[model samples]
Target chain A: MENKENILEVRNLSINFKTYAGTVQAIRDISFDLKKGETLAIVGESGSGKSVTTRSIMGLNATNADVVDGSIEFDGQDILQLDEKELSKLRGSKIAEIFQDPMTSLDPTMKIGRQVAEPLMIHQGLSKEKAMAKALEMLKLVGITNAEERINDYPYQFSGGMRQRIVIAIALVNYPEILIADEPTTALDVTIQAKILELMKELQTKINTSIIFITHDLGVVAGMADRVAVMYAGKIVEYGTVDEIFYNPKHPYTWGLLGSMPTLDTNEDVLPSIPGTPPDLLDPPAGDAFAARNKYALKIDTIEQPPFFKVSDTHYAATWLLDDRAPKVTPPADIVKRQEHFNKTKQG
Target chain B: MLDKDAPKILEVKNLKQYFNVGRKDEVRAVDDITFNVHEGETFGLVGESGSGKTTTGRAISHLYEPTGGEIIFEGKDVSKLKTKKDEKEFRSDIQTIFQDPYASLNPRMKVKDIIAEGIDINNLAKDKADRDAQVEELLETVGLNKEHANRYPHEFSGGQRQRIGIARALAVKPKFIIADEPISALDVSIQAQVVNLLKDLQKKRKLTYLFIAHDLSMVKYISDRIGVMHYGRMLEIADADELYAHPLHDYTRSLLSAVPVPDPEFERQREIVDYDASVESDGKQRKLVEIAPNHYVRAADDEIQMYKDRLNS
Candidate 1:
């Protein structure tokens, strides 16, 4: 089921931030691929370097950030090698990003229409009137009503959900090949979140743009992503189709994450929370970063980092338990029951 | 003495909190909402932004005087507490933990002083040494070290600052607490830790909590009963399991359906239920009607029967 045509191929990408305390190894040798028109979700806890990896793709990392090694190949061309003039051309026109908070991202002084139209004017060299006409069309496409009149208003005048709609319109105004949405719906309510997700799914189908959706919410990932990459300590611990990652997960970290999340279907008390906090990235562990917190961790997990073991042609996981000589270990009982429930639901 | 059928610690009757009242465009933040929270139970109030969950919480805590209705706490009508002594007593028994830990805490104040503010105001402590000891114990109660009391709020992380916030709320030995979206600001991993901490604290102190949050799943995990609100109106109120398993109201069903499950297969196949209030209400006056043994739904007379039929179906 693998697609040959790749839009973004990240290989052994290592990133570090030069902090005053010390060098923080934010991302360590992470690699993944995004096929054309596929929605790939990067899911992890806050400090797991999900944002760092995605931002590096957009060349939006902090000034203290260093791309230690590796390459980011976008549509057969390495983006890291592109000059500033060339890179700016590709940024909004080819790879646009929508951040979590629209209030901070938008300029309070400017009107919503101009903010959306500015990208078109810069990238496409369209006249102000033409750009605004396209912006209004984009706003309507994102399900905003009274687009013609509302486009003249400032960001604060719109509601939280409407502001997000404006942000989405701005991002998709250029019809970028890739849309990097980092927790776009985290700030909105459930009803609004559902509407935004539906809008994004509809727009993706219409524009045929690959999306790198970054979120800590697995449920959001489940709804939106075709493929899932579970990151930990700046590495893709498990990469597979959404089904494989959710139902047939291999890594212990992935199991912990699934067990930790409370669902409407279950009445289990004490959501089996991962016992320990994420490892401090300033002094990253030598072995698996999740070793300390992982209950089913093997002795080898504490001694050496596990390589990505192939579970299938499309599934890969980094865990010592996947080794041939390692003892067979099943997932937590809750996860097992959840999968069984999923199977039943699927068949029913 | 607490009983299995204990009397309600809090009863909000026809509570109304309107912003910009008597104006051309008045906003009814909490429009005639009524509910009872029994002792030692977690009553979760959940809704989206602009839904008045926070306002309801603030009104119940006496942070904002209700424009209408009575908030009866421990047989005392707190909405009309006029005397300074009565207000002080109310403040001691009912405390709040604000959502944004960073903004709620005074950055310039030491942690000890922050936690001790309630104790000092209520005169719960005898002297400076007594206040220090009380602060230390409160700190330990919320899973923080006593040494943390000497530091400022800026020195702590978001989770730690929230723990300090919890300590501050608990310093007065309050019988009830209003935790307004407390864990929403923390990270996923830290969220669980704070939740676990809250649960443990609740069990230890036998405290009644009015937990306000938007995340339905987390609310279910933490709360025994939940009240669903939308646009300043209570839509439904029921046991968490019952509400999730058999949601009767269209708005309740839609809200439940909108919650993203972590399972990919379910999410892919799940259909979103849209409940339009204007269409459903049909310009009829709606009231909070009891449908089941303990379940309540906001519906018109005709819609109430429809909900009953839907529930039976």
Candidate 2:
């Protein structure tokens, strides 16, 4: 794991969006690195800055968005400092993205073959005939049946699941080094979502592309991600390997999220949900954004923001509870059960 | 969770809802499905998109006229109501909470007016002051403050808008509520909040709910008895725990297997059970048969014994 190279490194990235109401600080200063050929999932509720962080990597932020600070380094280049032309060249061919809704992602009027081929023509300068042939092959790679015949069909001809497959094909057609999928399968049903997630894993091994998977579903994250970053109120509260985040979570927000979701073995009548909504980002909170909802919040949590407390070489969490002086508090019963179950599995 | 002696609150017998009848693109959204909801119980209907669960909820709420069959509510046939007075009374007895809070709410109306629409129509209030007071109380009932009544729907968050929708539904004092994917549009943190609110309200008001959703885990948690729907048919129905523990139908098993649990170790080892749709279109006659006590599975005469055998093993 130490020998693996970091394909993309984001450092102290902060973004603010100017609106009529005020300036909304969408992404607070945060940093993380993506290892080559690994799937790093950013899990958070809506407006938690997971999408903003990923969108900035593609230089796809809105015109009103202001990158206040930080650097996005990829391939010996600072992506945040790249010119429009340079960024355009880097996108699609080097760092392609798949959006949430497949229905709106692809051009409805254009044929599926043309949509997939356009990126290749633009990024790689492939001939029309050559790009179309490659597009057909990519379609087949994505598990579309009768790819030759279906390549000529429009986006509307395919089902929701099939349309997402085409979206994946378009993103991976150029064999990009990084594939940023923003809630790729949220719109699809569970059965279709399962197939798509499986297809993604299979394709990742074949192409060896580092994926930045963004979604709010913890279940999907558990199945797909090698590493997990849990975000709340525009800041990453905790991050670690999937095992550490699921089995030994240190942050109160993470505990609330895990306990809120009922599993098959869950027998409790009431869920241990986090109380209150997220803080308004326009004003931004004074201290820790999660302190208002966290039951284990310390007095310092209300006045001073806690820095990252290292739990291990790979695991880090921002919580006052990790301080030596803070009293030890038990996590929810469900999370303790999860830890017990994980240990049992590890031993067996 | 459900009492065996509880009286039936709503019953649909071979209900059918079809669009574009006799056309090339005719869609049998809800076809020949039968189920009954007991009084004061959450009956969850779950299926994938385009599986007629939403259509079933709409048909029960009278959002669409059923193409065929009877919807018996509290011993009265809903389709047989002839008088305007009877229809108006029926309208107030059952309410629907739509899936999307953003679209279900009218942006122009104030929160108070949105909730009071039902009160005004039912003549439940005495005067304007009484109406305002009732609206304020309803808002507080759903975990909102009275100050929110003056604001428009656009000003509130997704969770708040959903709370307003619940308040409006409860404003009519309906005996039964049809919540069609109520919490699917909400965030995970907020989803639990809304589900808890619904459960609390049910205990307080003794309201029966026809909760329809595609999320299998959530449906299982909230529902006392669960019904699994497929293309246009009810594939299985049983006690919530029974259905999860011993799913008899192939489609039910596939749906259950496909649900990604939050446990990483369990998820990695989970195998997705694929259902072959060709088996359903094989032209064999099928019906919902009880294989175990109170456990129903859709099967043909030849497949019934196979299902029972599988259950025993």
Candidate 3:
């Protein structure tokens, strides 16, 4: 794992969207790296800029989106500085994105087989016969049964899960180095979602493609991620390995998120939901974006943003609670008990 | 605990909802299924997409008339209601909260008017001023203030809009509410808020609920009893805890195993049960067999014995 090469490096990335109202600071200064064959999950609620940060890697941000600062280095080249022509050359061949809704992401008029083949033809410049054969092969790879017959069918012909499989087949047809799945399974059911996540992980072993799985579901994150980036109001509030973030979280936002989710073992009537809404990105927050909702926020948190305090070699949390001068604070009892339960089970 | 002797508020006996019936391309959206929601208890119907949980909810709410079987509401067979007034009375007794908050409410109407629509239709309030007051009270009851009455649905956030949906549902003072994936469209933080709100309202009003959702954990938290559905058929039904602890049917087991737990270590070590109903059922006609007190599973005679043996084990 240590020897694996860094495929993508995002350093101090900030972005804004110019709307009629004003410029909305969508992605605050956030930094993270993706290893060659690892899955890095970005977890956050809606409008927390999790999607914006990941979409920036593929240069698929909205037309009004502005990259105000920092760089996204894919392989060795900085993607932000690249022109549309250069970005287009790298887009589907080197980096591909699978969006949430398969119905909307896929074309209604186009056949499923042809849609999957287009990327191969455009990226690798394969002939029609070659591309179609490869498209059928990719469809089979995604566990689409009767690929021979179903490949000719349109997107509407497939069910929700089957359509998502087609979308994945299209994204992975060219063997892209990085696969950006933005809530790919959110539209599917729990069983289908498990299958899709399993499929993605299985494909990673075969294709060795680095994945950026963006979703708000912590349960999904626990299952799929090698490393996790917990986003809050356009900024990464916590970043660590999956175990580190779940077992030894430092950020208040992460604690709230972990506590809010009702587990199978939950006996309580009401979950402790994170109070208040996320900060408005239109004006953006002055100090720490999460300070308003954070229960253990310090005075400095409301006035000045805290730096990323290193917890270990792989873990970092952007909160004043991690500061040496700040008073000691602990996560909720349920979270601590869950960690303990896991630890005990691991030991036994 | 739910009252073991409590009367069933709503009883669905072998309910079937089929689309394009008597045609070559007939689709059985909901197959023969039976369940009962006791008075003052929440009945959670859970399944994957295309499993017809929503269809069942709609059928029970009379949004879509069932193709077969009887929906008996409080000792009366509702599908057999002859007069329009009888049907209207039945409707006012049972209301529904849709999945998508954004699409459920009218964009052109003000929040007050939307909430008052139910009141005006049922003539629940005497005058316009009384209706407005009732609307405001409903809004405040759902955590929104009276000031939010005049604003349009577009002016509110997703969570606020969902609250308005709840308020609208409550406006009719219905005895039962079918919340079909009500919190699924909301964000994680707001989901809890909505679920808690629903729970509080249920306790306060002693309202019976048919809570339908795909999210197993949330359903478990809110429901006293749960029924697992697959491909428009009931797989298992039991106390939420019992169902979670000892899932009887293969489909139920698979559904439970598929739900991702938040513990990284547990999730990594977890075993996912993959059950394809078509393959497992072996094309046998299923019958609901009660293996334990108030616990039911759909299985053939041989499978029923197997389940009973497994329960003892």
Candidate 4:
């Protein structure tokens, strides 16, 4: 239904983690697609399988995590069946990754130039000198002003924001087709967080690379996402365009997420959090896991998982409330009022 | 807006907190930053990472010695206090709530003992029964059950752990507090819960807070008057409403512009501040002056000249 430019497609993906406690189902029957040059933001609270889903794409999930079902189709090949040798060849060259902490992702002993050139050397078969020059080019591409000089410095010499930029440069060094960023800016300050998000959007345009952006911040989702998939208890309960998720949210969990966001406009109101915590993934419920905490949960929601009902052409939600047989329901009046209030004040 | 009728609880003038790195040059973390906490009001100190917001908070609570300036608390000069007894008395009056609840709270101890540690040391509570009663009252005030005092901080959620931190601060019965980025470490959903709890507690206790954080949206949600700092200097300090509605300084405006509006439609169309354009000429050399009521800004000489020259052009 998009612009005939699907780069990556995930179908009914299920993954389980072999922890000492038990087999933890981190991802459950989740499916979504990333279009060329578009951002598909996977927004969820911590431990909601947002990162696990992306990590699975890169085959970077811990050894304990087993991909139980479904397939990830990338450039016409199923990624689930790839061996480490194959995955290694594909990773950093085709599916580069930028993780949460830039410090850990970067090597302490190595120079920044050598680290960025690692992918270029391995993937492009370029010489050390050529790769180093290309690494410095990538550094400048991500807006490092004095990239040529700073290439010799270690990762410790850079600030948090600068380190994150270096990570981005490394992620894009091989000119990857799909860039997977796992909470890349969560550790940064808000101002720097904004700059990085803006840089990502700018970089995506220049390279025409599809991005799988994973984060818990709705603020960042608002700034850069083209499509949003709301995850809850190892499942994507809502998948839609940014407008549908923000303006006409169907899932009750999405409502809680939207309501929890604190804005300058929400000055005097006592910010509401979702009543209870997310359901335990170790022993997840059969039906909608969100029913336990959802104030607007229907009986059907508790009995059986709702099908992906169409709200609009490109928007769908796993909620029974969107059913034609169901009675009409509206979001909390406070939510409606807050949306209007935010709209007026949010614009300059 | 506050009990302007009441006396000032904490007043800082020309406060300076300088740190010497390996070399001779000093990192002026808090350089000549001035602000005051009314008898009861949440005065927010906001900035990005290196803006010295936490340093200012630490200096205000006397955790760090100021290189120069005066800290007058309740009509006494805190900077001039030399004796341990006087400093200990000052410490009792102004407590601190650190950012990481896990790092701040002693993991080995139970919540009750942790809360009781300060009061017991200072002899704020006379008897064992009095100490237990005070702990219970503080626990209940922070919306925790009386039994929660027996449990360790690890047992509670992030928001609950922060509440325990709050209860600990309240145990000593401090009038003025420096809550340094209390909720920045919590989850996004739980951040609102903690912010609301802090606001409710502020109303109940009439506590004056020097709330320090990196998030402007959150700072706006909590602060009465906001002081913005950049590169160790107070860039701007104005009423929260006025600062957000009309940020005067280019740097302040740029900071405000960076705060992502949490609406999908608005975010796409919204104009983000370009880091290159805003601070092109000014690195660390920006002259700051108060242009209006409680609003100060820093800009390079060329930028200042350009502003003047443009107005005349």
Instruction: Please name the candidate that would achieve the greatest lDDT relative to the true structure.
Output: 2
lDDT of 3 by residue, A22-93 (tens): 999998898999999999999999999988887789888889999999999987899999999999998888
State the TM-score for model 3: 0.97
TM-score of chain A of 2: 0.98
**Model 2, range A28-90, lDDT digits (tens) per residue?**
999999999999999999999998999899998999999999999999999999989999999
- DockQ of each candidate, alpha-carbon based: 0.70, 0.82, 0.80, 0.60
Q: Which CAPRI category fits model 2?
A: high
- Quality class of the docking in candidate 3, CAPRI style: high
| lDDT at position B233, candidate 3 | 88
Q: What are the Cα lDDT values of the candidates?
A: 0.89, 0.93, 0.90, 0.83
Candidate number with the higher lDDT (1 or 4): 1
Clashes of 2: 0
Candidate with maximal TM-score = 2
lDDT of 1 by residue, A1-348 (tens): 395588888989999899899999999999888998999999998788899998888887888998899999997788877777988898889999998998998999999999999999999999999999999999999988998888889999988888998899899999999999999999988988999999999999899999999999989999999999999888889999998889888999999888877787656556677776678889988788899999898888888999999999999999989999999987898888867876786799
The lDDT, on a scale of 0 to 1, for candidate 2 is 0.93
Q: Rank the candidates by TM-score, best first.
A: 2, 3, 1, 4
Candidates 3 and 4 compared: the better one by TM-score is 3
Question: lDDT tens string, model 3, B1-313?
Answer: 4787889999999999999999999998889999998999999999987889989988887877788999999898987889988888888889899899999999999999999898888889988889888998999999999999999999888999999999999998899999999999999988988988999999899999999999999999989999988888888899999999888888889888999888887888878898866664477777789999989998887788899987887
lDDT of 2 by residue, B13-115 (tens): 9999999999999999999999999999999999999999988988887778889998999898888889998888889989998889999999999999999
